[model samples]
Target: MNINLKYFKEGLKDGVPIALGYLAVSFSLGIAASNAGLTALQGYLASFLCKASAGEAAGFTAIKEQVPYLEIIIVTFVANCRYLLMSFALSQRLNPKMNIIHRFLLGFYLTDEFFALSISQDGYVNPYKCYGAAIIGSPCWCIGTSLGIIAGNILPAKIVAALSVALYGMFLSVIIPKAKEDRYVFLSIIGAFFMSFILSFTGISSGIRVIIVTVLIASTFAVIKPRSTEDE
Candidate 1:
């Protein structure tokens, strides 16, 4: 697979938004890592190795709690189970003729945003184009994580706390765009907030409560309003 200049340029362009979003989120991760007693270099290494926001967050939390290494591994794996579904979908998009090496390269770059962008494109993906996205996106993810760790080390605790809000803000930004296009998503957001608040007030364990409420509400709605054939 010869990746051309044009493909690389396109990947860089497509990756810009993701890079911007990642900077904030990765910075928060770095801050959390620092607070968890990890060195700046260790934080960067973890981000580079995992390449997953949720998994890294879970790992940090687990580490902070002095959880065993096996438990940390389990938590990280569980947090990233969605990647399995994403990888399965992407496999369907690759050219059937592509070899194992090509698949492996594509898998390396298979982040959530990258998968969404790749699959949303029409027709089968060119291996070079996938390579281009990886070339462009990987650095943003890595560099942001590195800088965030460095910043976390040098900055005051209060400042780090303030900057941490950027992670949630980034999530909101991502969701807002999608919610505008999908009424169901918008409603689901409202339902989630309401359920979370009610559960919190009632003294439920926040994590378990969220899982229970989300499952119950989402399942009930799914059953009551099964997707129409047209919607499907």
Candidate 2:
């Protein structure tokens, strides 16, 4: 396969910002993993495999709860369902003549940040750029997770607790921008928060409760405020 050195180098530069962000976010994730009794290596592997914040959150919740394997699978899928849509959008941006291997590899590398970078590029998207970004960004995520776990184990409890709050702050940063841009998204987020709060009083396990709240809130919004074709 021919490497586009220019695009690849540009990709590496683009990935730096993403790598830095992942280091902080995945550090909080590692603390959560440690709280869930995961070893540093286990947290590293999990972060390597499950790249999304929401997906990793759900997986760690399931593990902490000792939920059944099927429940874990279902929750993880539901949390990550948006990636399917992201993949569809990205597929349209790829060169149709691109090989299946590159297509598959790009799919694996399509985290939210990378997807935005890839989709915004002019002309046909080269898989090599995604590869370059992943090469730089992914290891930092994994290493950050490992470091978080180690820090959680060694650091003062109060310090770890404070650092863990960064994950929620990062989530708010992501959604607040979209919420400002789209009322429907804002409403959905509000509904999810309200529903999740109510569900907290129930005897339902956190895993099942999340699945219920997400499905209900999303389904309600999907029906009530269906996006126009242009929105897609």
Model 1's TM-score against the true structure: 0.67
Q: In model 1, where is the ten-residue run with the lowest total lDDT?
A: 162-171
Candidate 1 lDDT over residue span 133-232, tens digit each: 6666667677667777677655566765555564455456556766697687677778888888888888754445656666777777778666563442
lDDT of 2 by residue, 38-73 (tens): 999999899888888778987897899999999999
- What TM-score does each of the candidates earn? 0.67, 0.68
Give the C-alpha lDDT of model 2: 0.79
Q: What is the lDDT of candidate 1?
A: 0.70
In the predicted model 2, the residue pairs found to clash are none
